[model samples]
Target: MLILGCMVLIAGCGCLGLWFAYRIRRRPQELRECSMALALLDTEIVWGATPLPEAFGILKERTDVPWQGFFGELKERLSQGESAGIAWKETMIAQNSHFCLKSEDWNVIGDVGKGLGRSDRTEQHKQIELVQRQLMVIKEQAETWSGKQAKMWSYLGFLGGIAGVLILI
Candidate 1:
């Protein structure tokens, strides 16, 4: 019974570790999803020339949490007549808990906040392109780290579990 219990405990630890590793790998994909959504938002702003609130409204419908919460919050803020810069910064801060993006990643996107809806279409387009490029870069780096780290974490978890079980015996 003691041996069986040790086995179970070790298995549980391994599962927990695997979950952590999965999250590590998944973070990059989540960022990519956000990046794609931003790209779509850019197109809407460029071609549709919609108001910020409405543009965000359109984006909110198509996304899940984080992005959904993100666009929805922006729409609400903009609809309430808040300035785009303030609204954006606040919303970006608010969404941090809902997302896995690092602070620098948030800062990268946050930098583009003030430019939204504050400029001529040409300037807005330029800022959007710049933001898109930055996001793509982040996405690339995330993919690279996740690719290598995914296996490393899994092995670390597995080995740690085995070590723990041996220690118990």
Candidate 2:
């Protein structure tokens, strides 16, 4: 009976550990997907030189996911700028979308930023500030969630170990 109980406990613990790991794995992918989608949206907004009437619609169609509130804020900020193209680029950079950059991509964006006309300078600065604020928020949220997840897993492991020891005795 004791052995059976221990086995069950161990199985439960293993399942829990797996579940947590899966969640941890999933989060990074979600972050990446969200980042990539945002990057793409930035590019499109700049290229279009127009505030998308259906920004959410564009995001949903491109990423096949619901628009998040943060993205909404970003869209609003971008739309407020005088020049959409410059606003888009600056916003993207300030948001630390650069973190998602590959070497080739970074180089390309660098070129684009340099080539942007002087008329868009003011809007560009505003975009940078807006994006940076958003990125900081995202980073904090990700860190907090990760810490919570780690603590939860550690507690589960300890409980599982105790159960195993009890069964052995």
Candidate 3:
């Protein structure tokens, strides 16, 4: 009876381990897709063109990732330009979406922010403050994503260990 109990436990653990492994295998693809999306956003910003609204819409539709108001303001600024009658700074503060940083657009915003203080005063510098704010948001979101992934991996490891112990018994 004791041996049977041990066998059962071992099977349970093995099942858990397999579940974790599957999750782990799937995560990289998600991350890769996310990274590629962000790269596309970066390309658009580098060219000084407005990002596709569809991209933002898709990101918003797909992920629960967090973002800041500043990104929206940046987008609006690019879309409306100086004549749009909206205060870029204020709009940045008002715009908030978890969807923003999940896409590649955040990185492009960061690059644009770095050039703000320079004498060249390119379009990149026009929204420097907004970009800086967004970069911070992106950094935070990346950390959060990493932490979650790590936790998932750790859980998988624990389950695997339990399975091994059960087998030994």
**Judged by TM-score, which candidate is best?**
1
lDDT of 1 at 93: 80
Candidate 1 residue pairs in clash (backbone atoms < 3 Å): none
How accurate locally is residue 70 in candidate 3, as Cα lDDT from 0 to 100?
Answer: 37
Off by over 4 Å in 3: 1-7, 51-55, 61-169
The candidate, 1 or 3, that scores higher on TM-score is 1
* Weakest 10 consecutive residues of candidate 3 by summed lDDT: 83-92
Error of 3 at 84 (Å): 20
Give me the runs in candidate 2 sitting further than 4 Å from their true place.
Answer: 50-53, 64-169
Give the alpha-carbon lDDT of every model: 0.83, 0.51, 0.46
For candidate 1, lDDT tens digit of each residue in 9-37?
77877787787788778788777777788
Residue 67 in candidate 3, Cα distance off native in Å: 12
Best by lDDT: 1
Better of 1 and 2 by TM-score: 1
Query: Order of candidates by lDDT, top first?
Result: 1, 2, 3
- Error in Å for residue 9 of model 2: 0.9
Score candidate 3 by TM-score against the native: 0.34
